[model samples]
Target chain A: MKFGVLRFPGSCDDVDALLAARRVGDAELLWHGERDLKGADAIVVPGGFSYGDYLRAGSIARFSPVMESVIAFAGDGGLVLGICNGFQVLCEAKLLPGALLPNSNLRFTFRQVELEVVQEQTAFTCACGLDGPSPVVLSIPAKHSWGRYYADEQTLADMEGRGQVLLRYAPGHNFNGSSNDIAGVSNERGNVFGLMPHPEHAVDELTGSKDGLCIFASMCLAVEAARV
Target chain B: MKARVLIRPKAGILDPQGEAVQRALPALGFEGVANVHVGRMVELTVEDASQIEPMCQKLLANPLVEDYEIVLDT
Candidate 1:
């Protein structure tokens, strides 16, 4: 499988994401202004300040030429993973549900956080390697300012019922005041996933933890599953 | 035509910036202040009045988390 990592002008983590994807498969960087996805099996929207965070984080980036293609690609059941600012972009583009609000404390926060795999059946997390008890937890680095996830009670309940809620902050690890401790969510189809944590930054244990590799590994299975 | 769009966090949605400002006011010895909310306003000129709503719905604001009101200048 080949992965395509997107690079907006202000994208600081594109290189890191590109390297992380390379660990799993061949990967290349796709420009935000370009219309081609370069025949990638999966698309990774890496985290960083895109379009200077103008209007709102991810708001302007949603309208980029590449995102238009991405929307169509996702609509066709292609695999897409959005991290941090990429998550915000997905929300703005309406490819994912809910909105990422400012942190309750109104400060930028970056630290190690614990996330519970909520929906392991989804394509993005099917190979989490969770063989034990319920609420499987993974330790990964999370870095963001506007990471607070908000969805109304009705919407949250619906998402939960449909297994659209993919990841939750374990115990007291809701660092951004996200509603219901939501760390990540997926589209109803489960093919597109978005999370605020920097999984790309967690691929190596020398820095922090290797638990994030579970997610990317799962994507490998997802691609195989889609083929069959 | 000239228009102003006001965007605010919908009622019941948490406004972190507003809360921080509200907390700072009390520290400055000001009391009796309540329900302080912070919002943004965008001023633009359009060729037609009909363009205001579409602009707000499409780009000026995010309908999911914010409520927008349009005011037209006479």
Candidate 2:
């Protein structure tokens, strides 16, 4: 599978995302201003201080020309993943269900977190063999001031009813004060995924953990399964 | 018309910068700072008055996190 990682002006994780995607298969870095989607099978919007976090995290970067293409790509049933600041961009673009607000403490948090895979059938986590209702713990890094996840009560209920809660903060930790401990979620169709944590940072064993590989591998397997 | 757009943090959301400013005000010889919520204002030069809503929706502010209004000059 070929992955295209977007690099907006202030994107800091573009290289790490590119390297992670390459580990799973072929990948390329696509500039934010480029209107071309480049025939990529899957797209990953990596984390960083896009547009210097001006106005709000991800708000400025969402207007980049590449995001228009990413929106269309996600709408067309292509697999799209947004991580950290990328998650904020997705929310700002209205591609995801909820918005990311400032942490209740209003401080930037940078730490390793344990997240539970609440849903495994989505394109991003299906390869983990997490077939049961139980949650699987995955270690990842989160770094953001506005990482709190929020949605209206009705929308939150709808997401829970549809099993759209892809990941949640493990017990005893509510990093960044996300609503209902939600750490990640996918679109209604389950194709577009967004999370505040950095999975690409955990993809290699040498980097301390290889658990994040499941998400990258799952996307590849999911696309291949669809083609079969 | 001269209008000011008020951008304040939505309710239930924390405003650390505002909090820090409020804390520093007493030391700066300012008294009676009841609630110090900081915000920004952008002065716009518009050729058409009908462009307000779209400009606010598209670029001026994020409706999810902020609220804005316009006042016409008397």
Tens digit per residue, CA lDDT, model 1, A1-228: 888999998999999888888887889999999999999999999899999999999999999999999999999999999999999999999999999999887889888999999888877787775565666788899888899999889999999999899999988889799999999999998889999998889889898787787788788888977789
DockQ of candidate 1 against the true complex: 0.87
lDDT of 1 by residue, B7-39 (tens): 999989999888888889989999989898898
RMSD of each: 1.4, 2.5
Cα RMSD of predicted structure 2: 2.5
Estimate, for each residue in A81-188, the C-alpha lDDT of model 2 and write its tens digit: 999999999998999987887787778888889988888777999876554345678888788888889887888999999988899999866767788999999889
Model 1 segments more than 4 A misplaced: A130-134
Docking class for model 2 is acceptable
TM-score of 1: 0.96
Q: Name the top TM-score candidate.
A: 1
Model 2 misplaced stretches (Cα beyond 4 Å): A130-134, B12-36, B72-74
